[model samples]
Target: MAWSFWQIQELNKNYDLTIVGAGFTGLHTAIAFKRKYPKASVLIVDQGLGVNAASNRNAGFACFGSPTELLANYQHLGRDAALTMAQKRREGIEFLAHTYGKACDYVPVTSHELFLDAKHDFEHVVSELKLLNADLKSVGFATETFKPSLNAQLEINQIEICGEGQLNPAKLHNALLDNCRAVGIQFCNAKFIDHQLLQDDIAVELEGGMIIKTTALVLATNGFSNTTNIKPARAQVLITEPIYNLQLEGNYHFDKGYYYLRNVGDRVLFGGGRNLDFETETTTDLSLNEFIQSHLENLLRNKLLQNVPFQIAHKWAGIMGIRQDGTPKVEVLGNHIFRIEGMSGMGVALSPVLAQELVELL
Candidate 1:
C-alpha cells in the first residue's frame, strides 16, 4: 500500500512515546518499549512505508565485523573500542536471531573475505588478521584458518573463509514489523521535528504542523539520519537473473569486502565498491551512479562472470550512517528526546543492539 500526505498529516498528532524512523532500529525500539511498558502508548512513525534505509537494502549477512572493518575502525578508534563495538554487533545479531527465528532465512555462512588480487588488498587483510586473531584468541572466539580452494571458481589469490553468513533483508524487516504489531505497537507514516521538553510532557512537532505529546521520543533513523548530524551514506546494489551452474555460494567479500556478492538459490546479488568513489557515493540520495555501476559491471565482465550470458535485473541503493566514531549515536537528545542513528554500514548487526540500549535508556 502507498501513502498520501493527508494520511501522514492525520497521524502527526499526539502520542505517549513517538519513535521516528521505522527502520530496524525504530521497529525494534517500538517492540522493546511495548515490552517494558505494556500499558504505555507506543507509536512508530516514518516518512516511508517502514522500508529500511539499509536494513532492507543490506546484503543480509549476519556478520560480526569483518577483519579489515575492525582494523579500519581500530585505526579511527583504538583496539578496545573497536573490539567492544564488534562485540556489541556480535551480541546484537544473536538477539535478532533469538527474537526472529532462522526461518527469516538467516543463515550463517563463511564470514571472512578473500583478498585474491591487488597486493595492497592482500597486505591489508594480513594486517587485519594479525590484530583480530590476537583479540579473538584472547577470549577463545578465534575462527581463522589458512585454506586454499577453487570453490568460488575464480582465479583469485586467496581463500580465507569461516564464521560469516547471509540472510533475506526484507524478511528481517517484515518479521520485525509483524512482531511489533503482535505486541500492539502502532505505526504511522509521519516525520518529527521541534523537540520541546515541558515540565510534564515532551512536545514533538511534525511536518504537518501538528504536534506529538509523548513522554519520551527516540531516534532510530540509522543511515536516513537527516534529523540531526547523523549522516547516512548511500550504498548501491545490483542483481543478476537466475543463472545455470553458478559457482558463487556463501557470503564472500573481496577488496576488503568493499565488493561483495552471493547467490540466493540461482540468482546472484552483488554490491559494494563505494570505497572506489567515496565523495560521489557519500550522499543520502537513493539513486545510483554511473561510475560505480560501470565499475561493478566491468568487474563482472572481466573478473567474475566473464562472457557469461546474464542480464542485469535490478539496481538500487541503500543508506548507511557514517561518523568519525564507527558507533551508532545512542544518546539522549534532550530531557525527553533520544537519538539512535548512525549504524555505520553495520546497521544490520548493530542497530538491534542499539535498540535494546535505547529501551534501557528510556
Candidate 2:
C-alpha cells in the first residue's frame, strides 16, 4: 500500500515513547513513565479487537498467593523465590490500595480456600495450612495468615486468609485510563503488525499501512506476545444471575488455585479450569471451551452452589501470559525496546510492581 502525503501526515506522529497493549502492565507503565518524565509525549496503541485483555476481564481477586499455590511455588522455585513472589504480591496489592484507593471498588474481605471432601480430608488440609503459615511468618506475614474455617452451608473444609481481597477489574482499568489521560498521554486503537529500529527512532507498523514513530517502544501484550518463552493461557469464567439471599462473599480458591469463585454482590463469579485441557487452553483465542466450561458449570451446580437454584448470567474467557517454568519476564529485548509480560495469571497483583521495574530500565 502506497501512503499518500495527506494520510501519512494525519496518521504518523512522533512520540517520546510508545506502548503497545492497553491492559494493566501497559497502562501502568505509561503512567509511571509519563510521571517520571512529565513532558514526554506518550502514545498507547492497542488492537482493541476483542475481549482479550485479561486486565479488564479477570475475576478481580486482589490475591497475592494462595496457600496451595505458594506451596507449589516453594517446591518449584525454592523458598527464597517463593517468598519473593509473595512479598511482591503483597507490595503490588498495597500499591493499588494506596494509589487508586476506592476508585477500583476494592473490598478487603476475607479470602477462603475450600477443600472439597472428595479431594482432601480435613486433617490433611490442616497440616498443609500449618506448613504454609509457618513459611509465611518467615517473611513478616502473620504466623497464622491462614486459619481453619468451615462453610457449613456447603459442608466443605476451608481456611480463611488475611491480606487478600477483591475488586472490580473494569473499574481499575477505567481508573488507570483516567490517570493516563490526566497526565496528557495519548491513545490509538490499531492492530500492531511489526516494528523496525531506525537510526534514531523505532517505526511501529500498524494495520492499514499506518506507522508510528517513537524514541522508545514497550511491549505489554502479555499472552499475545510472539515470544517463545511465553504462552497464552485462556481462563474460562462464568457468573450466576443474582441469586436471592446469596451468602457467598470474598475470594474463594480450590484445586490448587486452578479454579476460583467469589461473590460480586448477589452474583457468584467463578473461573479457571485451564488445568483440565492445558494444550487447548494454551492459546490466545478468546472463545469459550466447551469441555472446560461444562466442567465449571458442573462444579457450580453440584459443588459450589449445590441445591441453590440459579441461572448462569454470563460466560467469557481471558488470555493470560504464562511461562513453562513459572517465572516472570521483564527484560530488554533490544536497544530502546522492552518486554514486560509473562505474569502467568498473576498480573492483577504483579503488574503495578512490574511496571515500575520496567520504567526503571528507561
Candidate 3:
C-alpha cells in the first residue's frame, strides 16, 4: 500500500520514548514519564482503539491480597519476597485511591475467603490466619488483616480481610487516558509488529506498513507479550441478570483465588475456572471456553446462588500475564529497548508502582 504525503510525514516524526500497549502499565508509565520529563516527546501506541485488554476487562477488585492467596505466596516465594509483594500491592492500592479519588467509583468493602467443605479444611486455614495477619501487619496492613468472618448469613467457614474495596475499571481507564492526554502524551492506534535497534534510536514497525523511530521503547504488552517468561492466562467471566433484593455485596474468593465472585449492584459477577483446563486456558484468545464456562455456571448456581433465581446476563474473557511470583517482570533487552510484563493477574493492583519504577529507570 502506498502512503500519502501527510501519512509519510507523520511516520517521519521521532519520539523520545515510544511505548507499545495502552493498558494500565503503558498509560501509567507514560503519565509518570511525562511528569518527570515534561519536554520529552512521548507517544503511546495501542492495538485496541479504546481501553486495551486486561486493564478494562478485570474484575475491578481493589484488594491487595486475600488470606489464602498470601499464604500460597508465602509457601512459593520466600517470607521476605512474599512480604515485599504484599507491601507493593498495598502501595499500589493506596496510590490508586489517592490518584483517582472517587472518580473511579471505588467503594470500600470487606473481602472474604470461603472455606468449602471437603475442598478446604476449616481448621487448617483458620489456624494459619494468625500467622498471615502477623505477616501482613508488618507490611502496613491492620494487625488483624485476616480474621474469622462474623457474618452469619454466609453459612460457611470463611475469613474476613479488612479494608479492601472494588471499583469501576472502565472509569479508571478513562481517567488514565484523560491524564495522559492532558500531559501532552501522543497516542497512535495500531498493532505493534516488531522493533529494531539502530545506532542511536529504535525503529518500531506497526501494522498497515508504517515504521516509526524513537530514542527508547517500552513493551507493556503483558499477557500479549511474545516473551517466553510471560505466558498468557485467559480468565473467563459471567455475570447474572440483576436479581431483586440481592444480599451479596462484597468481594469474595475461594479455591486459592482461582474462583472469584462479587456483587455488582444486584447482579453477581463470577469468574475463574482456568485451573480446570490450564493447558487450554493458557492462550491469548479472548474467546470463552465452554468447559470452563460450564464449570463457572454450575458453581454459581449450586454453590453460590443456590435456590435464588437469576438469569445469565453476559459472558466474556480477558488474558493475564502469569509468572510464579505474581509480580511484574521488568527487563532491559537493550540500551534503548525495555520490556515490562508478567503481572500474574495482579496488574490492576501492581501497575501504578511498576510505572514509577520504569520512569525512574529511564
What is the full ranking by lDDT, best candidate first? Answer: 2, 3, 1
Using lDDT as the measure, which candidate wins? Answer: 2
Whole-model lDDT, model 2 = 0.85
- Report clashes for each candidate as comma-separated counts: 5, 0, 0
User: Could you give candidate 1's per-residue lDDT for residues 1-362 as a string of tens digits?
Assistant: 22331143334356778888877888878888888888887878777775545777777777766566666777878877877877776777677667674647777666436655566465546655655776865544545532334544666555555545677878888788777767867776666656787888888777778677888888777766664566657787888888888766777666655777778878777888888888877787888987888888778767777767788889888888876455665877687688888876677778877888878878
The TM-score of candidate 2 is 0.92
Clashing pairs in 3: none
Best by TM-score: 3
What TM-score, to 2 decimals, does candidate 3 have?
0.94
For 116-153, candidate 2 gives per-residue lDDT tens digits of: 86655557667887777887887777768989888898
Q: In candidate 3, what are the lDDT values of residues 54-167, reduced to their tens digit?
A: 987888887777777877878888788888877887888888888885878888788898876666866888888888888788879888878886446657888887877888
**Deviation (Å) of 32 in candidate 3:** 0.8
Clashing pairs in 2: none
> Where is model 3 poorest over a 10-residue stretch in terms of lDDT?
1-10
- In model 1, pairs of residues that clash are 109-164, 109-165, 110-164, 111-164, 116-157
